[model samples]
Target: MTGMSRCPAHTERAQTSLPALGIALVLLTVVTGLGVSMADAAIAGAERTPDERRVAAAIADRLVSADGPLAARSNVLNRSRVDDFDQSALERSAPPATEYAVSVEVADTEIASSGAVHSGTQITRLVVVEARESRTLTPDLTTTDTVTLPRRSAQATVTIDPPAGTTIWTVRANDRVVLHNRSGLDGSYEVPLIPYETTELRFQRAGSIQPGNVTVSYDAPRSTKESLVVTVDA
Candidate 1:
């Protein structure tokens, strides 16, 4: 009787208390882990700023290297003129997620003989550079001549029945006068010049707003009303 003296209710209470204590300890461990994680993240953020800047500078340096000694004068890089090599390097070192504006110019060079100070002022080559997350693909352009004029008049409709949304079509006669430019989106361009010499009708793909290829064909003026065919593929 003495050995089994514990009350049944007391045993039940003891068992419940143990489980409660265990649950409390588990919650405390989880909270401690979360606090430690947050502290580590804060420290990492503090450390990353300078490192990112340094990497950005290095990217700029590499970009300048391509132009040789003239690159030393350059302080910026434009994203538009980026060649394949520059593009690859930029992707590796500084990802597009980071925004950057780089201004590049060739430094001044001594004229050597007269010692004329050619200050590396920003020249026509001034490039506006920007880093972005997305890129617009260049459309594939193919040119085929429908007719080569022995003598082309500077003024004349070089395009026959042209595809829809065609522009920048140029026809030069005698190699000087600007005959026609359908550069605008819609409407007809009037050319007052008479056809002289072998006229060269050039239908160039002015480019498309979306990603696609544009095919433009030059049709003889005598062919049909709707003669020109310019195809655009994105």
Candidate 2:
């Protein structure tokens, strides 16, 4: 060749050492893995910041709506009668049920450094919330309630003092009802229950108080002569 071209063998070796398709595949795998990892992290981080607060606010607003299902539940405000309190309904009605209580804390978190272009310029403020899951069922039942109302009051008055910033309040009755105060989301209201039976109550919220319902799902009385039966399956 005119310029003393390199040997064909040398050229082949260099090409084999760094094949174009191989390099491209390696880069694609790295980029894809990074993308998936970032998406996962974003979802996980959403539970603790502005995203969490936004979700909480939306839930609170929805709970206040009359059309929202949070107001009606077997153990909650299902003011009407049903064979069994619908656990499925409660679950479907309010997603991300933060158990016994949901506590919201607003704060600011500093962003130490910005490594690349198009990044935010200042420290970001964050909303932190701690949801206190209901522990009533895990190890024991700890709810204490006492009822004293007229036999036929068209409206029953119950004052509930839930944690502050509560969006939804769910109530379950032992009996009947005449009217329910469609109150705001402040955790206090007068509710009318049916005549002559004890009621079990649970309060929950996604964004606002779940609608109330009347039900005959009072707990059954236990007889003194009843014995417990235990069976073990092999």
Candidate 3:
């Protein structure tokens, strides 16, 4: 009878232990599922960084391209347009897929920007800014028969100060007749330079004024290096 009682007690203990084992297995499964989910999230977050970086780089490239909104030529920005840039223009120029921000700097001066910048992938691109430059040209006719422009010019202000008796007749640029006055010429004349080639201005039939003075003013397209930063947030 004592042995029979012990067997029944053992069975009861086994049944109680089975529930505990089942509970422990359920807890283990829950913990494992949580760990897998956390790992997947981490991996997804890591992959997003490269995507943001690529997007930022592509946007920057487009901004500095020849056909880009801010560019006058390939990788060259128009200084006047850049100065006029605002957030609205920037957004219109660069439409981001996700949240993003952009800032442009020329010669260490922050020129334009868009959106709010925070922690994000950034891309830096080299850009050139075309700034208008002015210079004065003085012709030394006494030294030489022809005066050659140092650089390509689009316009000039010609002032003829001839001697008492002599009068200017014609002006030729690179053998092409730009100005022709059969009677006589004096005073200031605005001349347009040839677009295709370099201009060599030659004065014909000037009086005692051995050295004639001509002022050629033009827009000189100058370029400088700048940094364009584009940042994208995911």
Score every model by TM-score. 0.28, 0.21, 0.67
Local accuracy of candidate 3 as per-residue lDDT tens digits, 41-136 = 889878988888887888788888888878877887888888887767767777773246666555566566665656677778887777777766
Q: By TM-score, rank the candidates, best first.
A: 3, 1, 2
Note the Cα lDDT for every prediction shown. 0.38, 0.35, 0.73
Please state every model's RMSD to the true fold in angstroms: 20.9, 22.6, 6.5
Off by over 4 Å in 3: 1-47, 97-99, 194-198, 210-213
Mind giving the per-residue lDDT tens digits that candidate 2 earns over 174-223? 43332233453343355555534444344333332212321121222211
Superposed model 2: Cα runs more than 4 Å off: 1-10, 20-49, 52-234
lDDT for predicted candidate 2 compared with the true structure? 0.35
Top candidate (TM-score): 3
Which stretches in model 1 have alpha-carbon errors above 4 Å? 1-11, 57-81, 87-234
Pairwise TM-score winner, candidates 2 and 3: 3
- Candidates 1 and 2 compared by TM-score, better number: 1
- The TM-score measured for candidate 1 stands at 0.28
